[model samples]
Target chain A: MGEKIKVDRVTKTFVVRDSDQKGARKEFTAISNMEFSVKEGEFLTIVGPSGCGKSTLLDLLGGLSTPTKGRILLDGQEIKGPGLDRGTVFQQYALFPWKTARGNIEFGLEAKGIPKREWRAQSDHYLELVGLKSFADRYPHELSGGMKQRVAIARSLAFNPDVLLMDEPFAALDAQTRETLQSELLRIWEKTKKTIIFITHGIDEAVYLGQRVVILSANPGRIKKIVEIPLKHRLADADIRSNPEFVKARHQVWSLLHEDEYAGLYI
Target chain B: MVAISKQVKSAKRLHKLTINPLLALQKLVKQSIVLLLFFVVWEIAPRIGLVDPAFFPAFSEVASAWWNMLLSNELFSHFSASITRSIAGFGLAIAIAIPLGLVIGWYPIARDLLNPILELFRNTAALALLPVFILLLGIGETSKIAIVFFACTWPILLNTIAAVRNVDPLLIKSARSMNISSFSLFYKVILPASIPTMFTGIRMAGTGAILVLIAAEMVGAKEGLGYFITYSQYNFMIPEMYAGILTISILGLIINYGLLALEKRLSRWKQDPTV
Candidate 1:
């Protein structure tokens, strides 16, 4: 596998005015000296506690925000700003409320200057891939949470970006829907072979979905450890959760994240 | 169980046939009865000497006066003149306010420079500036149109600014991540997102245009609904004045409904019945 993304010594600082104290300002370090690398076509998941800067790191990778210290690279080119090379799926399911599911899916394609004649067929394909063919005409407000997320995924995939940056895309969903989407996402990743950087706060999800799970420590967010799951094969069935290797991998990530200071905080 | 199920099915069919139509018919009847009662009282009160006939005319007398004005073409000319002036002023306000609002809302520097001035002018009543407008533009169509423009501009401008600024940040972030060009971003995301709020401002400005125009006419115009009503009052033509007032009310209603229909068409996505 080739190196797809390289995050080298990235640090993000936010300067906030102290509203309670007159003329006082403070600097906050969200992530400090964070470094990681992802291989091409790999499903890499980063799991962390709240405020661990998982989303911030993903933002940097997607070129939505600039790092205060180091830099990120894609295919040996330093990331400067948002581009079509990296497609991001936000936790809020950021489909334009004014557009229907099909329109939302076609948004990035349209931005890429694709011919108008191809937009419908391209959008229809993605909609079908996400199992939302019947709901192509529905607006975001008319869709359920799971359905909205599916549309969001379809939209990002239709753009055919080099990498998919998902920041807790399934966090808002219920348990059953989340599981169903998790399987669907795996199936998509296998078929498309697109590099995915998935960020989540769920330990079970990180182990279940990622080829390598990177556990992040809070308080100036930094990577604590990276664990590689030794599954015999890629998840081909929903019953993988019952396999010994899966449970063991989940427990290993849990203990690492559940250490003294962060104990009792549910992942 | 079978008998109970059969009875329930029959009851459902009965409800669909009778209750639904009965409810709709009842609503129509209720509304008509209220309007009819109002007209009946209006017709009877003045004729029975419940009020002074010089000041208060019966419904029939007002209707006949309205017909007379229509035949003479006096009401039509005044009505058309008022409509044309108001529409011109309202259109000018929309053309200016929307672009200004979009620029100010999008750029912090522009907002900072203009906010104080906007607040100052918005708070000052447009009617209070009629004398100044007349002095500047002279007591002609220009001055009347200017006053209407001033009255309508503030609401549309302020609402548009608020709308553009308050668009969900996540939507913009998502759009930007797709590498959308700035022009496409504004056209596809920002403008559409801000439309509902912008429409609110437009509707307010529409109402404001008519109001300010009528007030300006009342103060110093020779032709308009306001002038027609005031002239009739001065000459003690009570029924003619009532007719003018009714005409103005109907005009306001028509403007409001037209704007409402436009808003509905533009924002059909908002009406999610399933939600």
Candidate 2:
């Protein structure tokens, strides 16, 4: 019950049934022999190619589904199923379409039977934290792509979960909005300092957001490397894209990825 | 170019205001005209000898019979009895069907187990089983209510299941991630999402329940509009039968309009994306 989380040699396999009339089933290994530990108050990112099962690993860690083998531990206790300790934000902005932004944020608290007066104050606070105070009454369909995600983040954060798990939460947003929300997330992260595990297919985003970025292989998703950033503080959105160290680290990761594809750098 | 586009937008706005309202007015006017034409034809056709006067009574004759029934309070008694039975059956059906449907839809195992039995029972038409209901419960209020319940429960149950099953999985995932429990999950998330569709089911059930009760009342009912219709027809009072028919249709229209208002209130958030 001391450390934040530890993924101990987790291996997840899916039985992909063959569409051929013969009715054969084949095993598709999603994550194999994955081992990692997330420290308390750490921001860790897992990044790889689109089909690399980065999301699957997050699901495994969050106990959305069980792995075929190995176990994930949160605070040295084995994770069994979805619990109050870990909160998730889905990439597709999974805000309930029927609920207003304030309602969605208040839902978790309401489930716990929190008094209406307290829930109102806390929900408003989270809405303000995500800079979506004006959009409190708006439904998911009324909000823009970015606004929906901000509300999603607010809902997850409102419960004050021990660990925050994000699965490429900003991937669907336009580039400008993505970066703006990234900085907003950084500000929120600084204030809360909760343990976070973010999964992404975007390398630059992984490097920018993570204190340590863990890269995984394509299929049979296995951990390849973990790169630690030297900086103590997150860079400003403008500064992040322009910083020499950020650019250099990003290029290095890009080359490592592209090297697997083409076997040589062109420039 | 921007100014021209803005001016074009304004022009389009004006065009919409002029044309859309006229289109809506035309629709309303057209419906009213069709109703007026039907009444006029009915009024004139019998006198002009275009159709048999025996089968088709004059509109004036029907209206006079309606007035007579109203003055004698016979129509009120029949109407009130029919309405009470219909509403009571509908309320009971809703009480049973909605919770059961939600359970079957929310849990896959329950749906898988119960679906075959439900489908088999649903296929047995409520009218065809009227004799069986009469045998089991006697030819009383029990039999009539049983028939209406059978007719009404299917639509409500099926619609509720459809609504619950079709609720977007994304919403469920979001709610789960927020640590919402299994019980509150259904009420807070699933119920709200399923309401518009559930309303459609209940409204359909309301009309079906009334129709079934009318037929049921024809079989041994002492006090109901259906009995009044058959009694008048047997007595060779064509206008009274026509008045009963008109009353039933008006009842249906009121139920439909009431549900429509409720649906509009509940689905305030579901705006057309194209707009």
Please tell me which predicted candidate would have the highest TM-score against the true structure: 1
Which portions of model 2 show Cα errors greater than 4 Å? A1-3, A19-21, A229-239, A242-244, A261-267, B1-49, B58-61, B265-268, B272-275
Give the residue spans of candidate 1 off by over 4 A.
A18-21, A232-235, A262-267, B1-23, B26-37, B47-49, B272-275
Model 1 / residue B172 / CA error / Å: 0.8
In model 1, state the lDDT of residue A163. Answer: 97
For residues A1-267, write the lDDT of model 1, one tens digit per residue: 999999999999998787888999988899999998999999999999887898889888888899999999999899999988889998999999999999999898898888989999999999989888877887887677788898999999898898999999999988877887898899899999999999998988999889999999887889899999887555565499989889899999988988747466534
What lDDT tens digits, residue by residue, belong to model 2 across residues A154-251? 88888888899999999998887787788778888889998889988787788888888887767667877888866555644457656788887787
Candidate 2: chain B TM-score equals 0.88
Clashing pairs in model 1, backbone N/Cα/C closer than 3 A: none
Worst 10 residues of 1 chain B by lDDT: B1-10
lDDT tens per residue, model 1, B80-130:
989989998998999999999999999999999999999999999999999
Q: Which DockQ values do the candidates obtain, in the order shown?
A: 0.39, 0.27
Residue-pair clashes, model 1: 0
- Candidate 1: global Cα-lDDT? 0.90
Global fold similarity of model 1 (TM-score)? 0.92
